[model samples]
Target: MKLKQAVTGMAVLACMSTAAHAQSAGTFFFSTGWFHLAPQSSSDPLTVTSIGGSPTNITEANTGASLSSADTIGFTGGYFITDHIATEFVIGVPPTFDLEGSGSLEQFGKLGQAKQWSPTLLFKYYFNAPTASFRPYLGLGVSRVSFTDAKITNSNFEANVLHGPTSVSTDSSWVPVFNAGFTYAFDQHWFAGVSISYLPLSTTAKLNSTSTTVVGTLNIQSQTKIKLNPIVTYANVGYRF
Candidate 1:
């Protein structure tokens, strides 16, 4: 009787252990990776004119100094509400960009720099599969972008038929965003993904005089509204705990 009771108790404990593992099949994970955002297009106008004089209207076109792609790095923390539903918070440094344009017929070197930081909340839905490997997901989120510590240099332009230089500066604002992507899980603890997002960023810029020839202080204010379509491709390593 003693032997039989001991066997029964061990069998119950084993069954409980199996049930617990099955309930927690999906795990929490943290990821950090490098991101590259290519400005597929910008609808913002690059307005250039004299500070105190009549400003020239430069419309948004395939001309002048515009951004191409910027390098970015960020981190993410997420958890699985279920095997098919999850949420995450992503934080990262803005991609560094350069504007390529001729200053009054002279090509300037990297006219300025704009850096951004954003915290985004996202909801993800995973596809059900026989195996966890090769799991694909889609996501949506909102982001707040802050641009700061912008610096401009080596700018020259043509004004009143006289060769002169100009100074460019700007302030940042918030934008609405949307994104979609797919993640492929290589194992229980590793994954990689790719995504694209649209960001509506608009702001005003203050033009200042940085020319020795151009006299008087100019305060030309211009408004620019841009919708950025960024194709983000990234590969990340994640740890599930």
Candidate 2:
């Protein structure tokens, strides 16, 4: 009876130690990754006329611009609320874009490049033990994005007869965002993850008239609306403390 009791006590102690170790395994992490923004619906409206005395409405004519490939990078920190649940804060930079066209007669340019800073709050649930092998997890979060110091270049016009120059400037606004992601751990301190986030943003731009040495200065005012969706992918090396 005494031997049996001693063995039972040892077993209980070993189980407790294992649980404690797993609970305190990791408390901090950092990651860097590359991201891209998928195309979303965009519109531009302008009131101008062709030199042939024809009405030209950019938006009504579906003559706008498309964006190009962009790069994104971010950092994150997390704290465990329970043994299998944690909350994290993620911050990222605004992605830059270059404009393309669909072979329309409208004037096209780079439009501008935008940069954003976002702070997101997330909740994570770990389904398996935080081991040195594969550990998969899920997260959900809300983000706030800001755009700054955006610049535009290559804003010119091309037509059969009207060959001249034009320019545009813009201002940005705050947007609300949401994201979902999964992370795969290769070791106790390294992992990779991919996430997708949606942003509801719009802006307005000022159109400037240009001269082709004959048409002189043509004063014009126009408005543009832009909506975006960004998908982020990342691979990181982290440490547990």
Candidate 3:
């Protein structure tokens, strides 16, 4: 009858209102999805810093490296402080990148590989009202960047270029991140988002090699400074609590 119809209409309206205010204050959200990382990378010439525990600065000519693009799963967790402000923490399953030899080292092809880890925390400002279905945001943050499993994987390069058996190590540092993205709420609890971030980062790869001369085995220490300015893209689906 009329009473049942009225109740049903009111219920529908209530559902719509709930869905409309998905990004309101005091909301906590979590998302998981894909991250693609592309590095605008460059490196200083490879240098032999020391030989047999003695200082000998010898730089190679046209010997540098480039990093290959990588992809991995990414996650984001955030809390809304207000209708237009939020804080988020982002991380990814560390992706391994290939180091391709450049310039004078180009003939060696694959120089090495390493896994990169960068966990970031961002303070964001969202544009538009809380009730809107789509919102865009800009964020500023810092990342703790590190590397692991770095090594000279090419044996030919290790023997001919390094002139020995070589092992690798890398330095860690802190870098700033610039981020921007947008989210579209499907309802009160479900949403989809895409984001892009940039980081200006650099690290040094240190190499230790043992070479056998006519005399004996000599330990050689060498290093190269590399700039890895990467642009990262993320696409995810999320739920709000």
Backbone collisions counted per model: 1, 1, 0
Candidate 1 error regions (>4 Å) = 1-26, 43-64, 102-109, 129-131, 157-171, 200-203, 210-227
Worst 10 residues of 3 by lDDT: 15-24
**Alpha-carbon RMSD to native, per candidate:** 6.0, 6.1, 2.0
The residue pairs in collision within model 2 are: 94-116
Could you give candidate 1's per-residue lDDT for residues 206-239 as a string of tens digits?
5454334346544443334444455665556666
Best by TM-score: 3
Q: Positional deviation of 222 in candidate 3, in angstroms?
A: 0.8
TM-scores for all candidates: the values are: 0.68, 0.64, 0.94
Q: What do the candidate models score in CA lDDT, each in turn? A: 0.58, 0.56, 0.93
Candidate 2 lDDT over residue span 134-185, tens digit each:
4456666666655555544444442221233445556545555555556665
Task: Give me the runs in candidate 3 sitting further than 4 Å from their true place.
Answer: 1-17
For 1-241, candidate 3 gives per-residue lDDT tens digits of 9999999999988876786556877899999999999999999999999999999999999999999999999999999988888999999999999999999899999999999999999989999877778999999999999999998899999998798999999999999999999999988899999999999999999999999999999999999999999999999999997
Count of clashes in candidate 2: 1
In candidate 3, position 92 carries an lDDT of 97
Which is the better candidate, 1 or 3, if ranked by lDDT? 3
